[model samples]
Target chain A: MLAKRIIPCLDIKDGRTVKGVNFEGLRDAGDPVELARRYAKEGADELVFLDITATKEKRKTLVKLVEKIALELDIPFTVGGGIGSVEEIADLLHAGADKVSLNSAIVRNPDLINEASRQFGSQCIVAAVDAKSQGDQWEVFISGGSKNTGKNALKWIKEVEERGAGEILLTSMDRDGTKSGFDLELLSAVNDITSIPVIASGGAGTSQHCIDAIKKAKADAVLAASIFHFQEIEIHDLKEKLKNADIPVRETI
Target chain B: MIAIINYEAGNLASVSNALQRLTIPHTITNKESELDKADGIIFPGVGHATPAMASLRENGLDSWLKQTTKPVLGICLGMQLFYESSEEGDSEGLGVIPGRLKKFDSSQHKVPHMGWNTFSDVNAHPLVKGFGTEEYFYYVHSYYAPENEFTTASCHYINEFSSVVCRDNYMGVQFHPEKSGKEGSLLLQNFIQIVSSE
Candidate 1:
């Protein structure tokens, strides 16, 4: 059986990890390399580096940062934000990212997913879906959740899979950064429709919430940024709590 | 020194960086001469088997990989290429290891077995000796090679399948030790030690 994954997302800006992560042993969180090493030390199953604002000039710096982090950390890491073409995705993969997540670009050109999966592999492509609840349904949002695409969430989920996406990173815009809890209803509905692995994102406040994301939402993985960034929850402690809750997690030293 | 065969498949950086972290001298090469000089070979790959095999054939690595006798380790798609053939791209493998690759039935479990999974029915080998029998390692692949006489370790996902396989001088593992964490680092350390000893 595959163990559930607990991922800590690092929001990067101009080649630096924003929202500092401080502890006794770890260095400054401003350095992505140091933060990556620290997260690996704390037994993080995987890490996601999202370049919050990826500009044309800052792309090289971000790639260099990714290479540095990859050199020191042994765990699998993903790179997202401003991933537009297959050529760019190939370049990042060679630079040391195990996978690349696509958002707005994929929404505009769905064939990019198929082309990339053929050029690289489905396992290397992660389709990030940012959705907000609207009445009885959930609407898909893009452009870093700033613009509503006016597309149905469930329909888009199936389209990505059929277009050759390996995994879906479902983020709830309404609950993001709130730390209230995961959107269980949305996650469950998405998981029910698609057979692919769904990573539940948004609103992870406590360790119990992570458990609920797995047990209740049936998410294969739970991804959080703010909770992990503020040092409210340590990866090791969270893994321990999840293990005790009957959820099989990777054994961290 | 270990040589990571670069046949145009992605993920070579991760494998090379893992070796560097262990302080083991290694090179990422597609040249037959460099591969010939290296003590051990690590065939790293991702993506489909057809294009991967084509890349190997284009660079003349297909024949070279089959003829080499030094200890060689294959990861993910690399492991799949060791078999007689794979159903992923309907391409023929190196025939170095005696087996055929099969795709997992999504009806049984998830298509790609992504994330960490533990080992069962592990045999004593230098590469896996330092780790526990049940220690979990990260895996990300859709097609898998079935168990046979060369299977060194087995793991259960949708069904019981061979996760680690070794045939004489060639060894293969479905999981990516480079991405597996502390236990994974130890496993790579063990591989380096095995190569250095040889």
Candidate 2:
């Protein structure tokens, strides 16, 4: 059986993790390498690094940092943010990123997804969708969730999947960072439509919230940031809880 | 030393990255001579079989690999290329292993078996030695090589597919051990151990 995945997302800036991750035993908590090592050790099914670096030179630093993370962590690591071109995506993959996520860039040129998937295999391309609820349906947002594309979220998912996206990273903008819980209604709506795996992101506060996202919402994977960055929920304990709940997760200990 | 074959199939960094952590000296090369320098070869691929096989042939790696007696481990598309042929694009394999690649029935199961999945029916080969009997390895693929005489381990996703296939001088895995967490690292360590013994 395929184990439900628990992923920790970390934002990178200036070649360092944006969130002040301070897990004990980690010599450098803010360092992406150390934090990634801890997450892998604690049984994170996967890790996603959103390179929020702004400067052109710092982007090079992010690439170097990606190679370092690859050397340090053995789990699947995904790099996203500011990846707009095939050349850039190739650089990250060559730097040892298992997969690359595309958001605004994918929308800007949907052909990019087709071309990338053709070059790197659909398995390595992740289509991340940032969406917000509007009336009954959801609207897709781009530019770091600041602008609504007006394209229906559910409709976009079908397009990306058909366009050869292997997986969908669905984030609920309204629920992001709320700590209330994942938008189950939004997640379920996406899950119900797509055959490809759906990763539910945003609004993860409690460990139980993750469990519910899986059992109730039928998410193939759950991705959270603050909950993991602040150590609000230790990955090891969370995995234990998920295991006890019969969710079939990897054993960290 | 291990030579990670470079045929422009995709990135060779992940394979090299895992070897670096294991303290295993390795190099990424496409030259036919560089392959003989290493005790073992790790063939990694990430694209369609048609173009991948094309690159291998262009570099004469197809013939070199078919003739090499040293341990050659194939990953993902690399593994599919070890068999006689793949249904994907009607591509020809290295013919190192006698099996046919089959695409997962999307009607019954997901086309690409993505995420962490457990391996079962593991054979007592050095490749799987000292590893936990039950473990999950990261995998993402729409096609898989079915079990045959070279079958070492099997994993169930949509159905029972050959997870690990091994024959004389060649072993292949459908999953990315480099990205499979602790268990994957252990598997790579075991591969290194296999190379050292040879």
Candidate 3:
């Protein structure tokens, strides 16, 4: 059986871990490699390092950080943020990242998804979609949830899968950083339309929220930041709760 | 030293990085001379089957892989390539194992069978000496080699398939041991022990 994955998404800026509320008001978290090692020790199935840095030497710093984390962390990790070209994707994979997530890059040039998946294999390409609820439907937001792309979230999800994206990292902009719970309706809607694995992101406040995402929405994985980062919820205990709920998860060996 | 056969299949950095953490010396090479010099061969790959076989033949590693008696460990697509053929590209394999790779029926189950899955119905072998059915390994592939005479352990997704297979000196695992965390590292250590014993 394929266990439901629990992921800790780390927002990296200038080579350090940071977290922002609703994609603004960033604050220092901790050292990325150190935090990553701790998460792996506590049983995080995978880790996502979203580079929120905005420097000219950003890629260089991210590559260095990825190499450092890969050297220390045993589990798989992904690098994303401002990854525009196939060459940049190649550089990150060469630096030891097991996969790379694309957001604005793919939205700007949708062909990049096809090209990258064709070149590096779809299993390594993740399409991260930040969706915000409008009056009746959800709209796709890019540039870290600041700009709305005027694209329907469901349609974009279909397009990415058709374009060969192996996975979908779906974030709810409406519920991000609120810590209430995951947007189950949105998650279920996306899961209903796509065959590829959908990773539920944003609005993760408690272990119940994680369970709801998996049990209710049928998410293949759940990703949270502040809850795991601040020690509010230990991954070990969360896995126990998930198991108690009859959700299959990988035990920390 | 372990030589990771490099036929431009995919990234070899994670494999070499894992070995480095284990303090095992390895080299990524496409040359037959370098592979012949190594104590063990680590065959790693990712991507489609047709082009992969083409690249292997282009570099003449196919014949070398078919004949080499040295302990060889194949991971993911590398393992799939050890069979007689695969439905992925309608291409032929190295014919080292008596089976063909088949794509998971997506109508009933999700394609790619991604994430942590465990193997059970184990047969005692050095590569899986300590591994149990409770132990899980990272997997990300669409095609799989069904359970056969060469299967050492089996995992259930859409159906029972050879998650780990061994024949003589050649061993292949459908999971990425390097990316599977503690169990992954332990599996790699087991392979290191096999190579060291040789």
Candidate 4:
């Protein structure tokens, strides 16, 4: 049986791990390499490092950090943020990242998804869709959720799958950092429309929220930041709760 | 030393990094001469079988892999390439193992079968010495080799599939041990032990 994955997303800026509440106020968490090692030890199924700095000048530091993290971390990890070209994606993968997540770059040039997937294989290309509720529908937001693309979230998800993205990291801008819970309705809607694996992100306050994301929305994985970063919820204890809820989670001991 | 076969298969770095962390001596090489100097070979791959096979043949690794007497372990697409053929691009394999690879029925289950899944029926083999049914390994693939005579261990998703396949001198795992955490590291360590024993 495929266990439901529990991921700890480390938002990286200036090579340090930081968590933003609603993508605005940045709070220092800890060192990325140290946190990554701790999370792996705590039984995180996978790790995602989003380089929030994502500047052309900062690309070198991100690559170096990725190489360092890959040296210490054993589980599969993803590196994203300002990954525009196939060359950048190649550099990250070559640096030992198991996968690379693309956001604004892919939205601007959707063909990059096709070309990157074709060149690196879809297994390594992840399409991260950040969305927020507008009226009755969810609209895609890019550039760290600062700009709304006005694209229907559901339709864009289907397009991304068709473009050969192996996985979709669907984050709810409305739920991110709120710690209330994941946007279940949005997640389920995206889940229904796409066949590729959907990773539910944002609004993870408690273990029940994680369970709801998995059981209610049918998310293959759940990614949270502050909860794990602050020790508010220990991954092992959360997996215990998830296991008690009959959700298949990897062993955490 | 373990020589990781580098046929332009996308994931040589992670495998080499894993071995380096384990403090195991290894090298990534496409040359037959380098492979000849190693005691074991790790064939790491992640991509479509067609292009992977094309690269293998282009580098003349298909014949070398077929004739190599040293212990060989293939990961993911590398394992799929050990079979007779794959439905993915209708590509032919090295034929070290019988049968062909089939795509999972997406109508019934997820296409890629990603994430941690446990394997059962783990026959007593050196490569899987301490692995049990409860252990989980990281997997990400669309095509799977069905359970067959060469299957040493199997996993179930939509259907029972060969997760670990082995025969004399050759072993293949559909999961990425290099990225499977502690248990994954243990599997690599076990492989090195097997190489040492041989």
Model number with the top TM-score: 1
Share of reference contacts found in each model:
0.86, 0.79, 0.71, 0.82
Give candidate 4's error at residue B26 in angstroms. 0.7
Worst 10 residues of 2 chain B by lDDT: B128-137
User: What is candidate 1's local distance difference test score?
Assistant: 0.88
Please, what are the lDDT tens digits per residue for candidate 3 over residues A1-253?
Answer: 7999999998899998876322212232368887788789889999999999899999999899988998898888888999999999999998989889999999999999999999888899999999999989999999988899999999999999999999999999999999999999999999888888889999999999999999999999999998887778889999999999998899985
Q: Model 2 in CAPRI terms: which quality?
A: medium
Distance from true position, residue B143, model 1, in Å? 0.6
Candidate 1 regions exceeding 4 Å error are none
With a 3 Å backbone cut-off (N, CA, C), the pairs that clash in candidate 4 are none
Span of 10 residues, lowest total lDDT, candidate 1 chain A:
A20-29
True contacts kept of 4: 0.82
Off by over 4 Å in 2: none
Give per-residue CA lDDT, model 3, range B1-198, as digits (tens): 999998877558888888999899999999999998999999998988888899999999999999999999999999999999999869999999998899888777667788999986789999998988999899999899999999999999898999999999999999999899888889888988998898
The residue-by-residue lDDT of candidate 4 on B27-119, one tens digit each, is: 989999999999999999998888888898998989999999999999999899899998998989999999989989888766778999999
Candidate 2 chain A, poorest ten consecutive residues by summed lDDT: A19-28
Tens-digit lDDT string for candidate 4 (A77-191): 9999888999899889989899999999999999999998888898889999999999989999999999999999999999999999999999999999899999999998988
Poorest 10 consecutive residues of model 4 chain A by lDDT? A20-29
Better of 2 and 4 by lDDT: 4
> Which digits, one per residue and each the tens of the lDDT, describe model 1 over residues B77-136?
998899998887678999998777889888866678999999877888887786655688
lDDT score, candidate 2, position A126: 96
In candidate 2, what are the lDDT values of residues A180-235, reduced to their tens digit?
A: 99999999888888888899998999989999999999999999998888899988
- By summed lDDT, which 10 consecutive residues of candidate 3 chain A come out lowest? A20-29
Query: Compared with the real two-chain complex, what DockQ does model 2 have?
Result: 0.76
Predictions in order: lDDT: 0.88, 0.88, 0.90, 0.91
**Candidate 3 at residue A19, lDDT?**
67
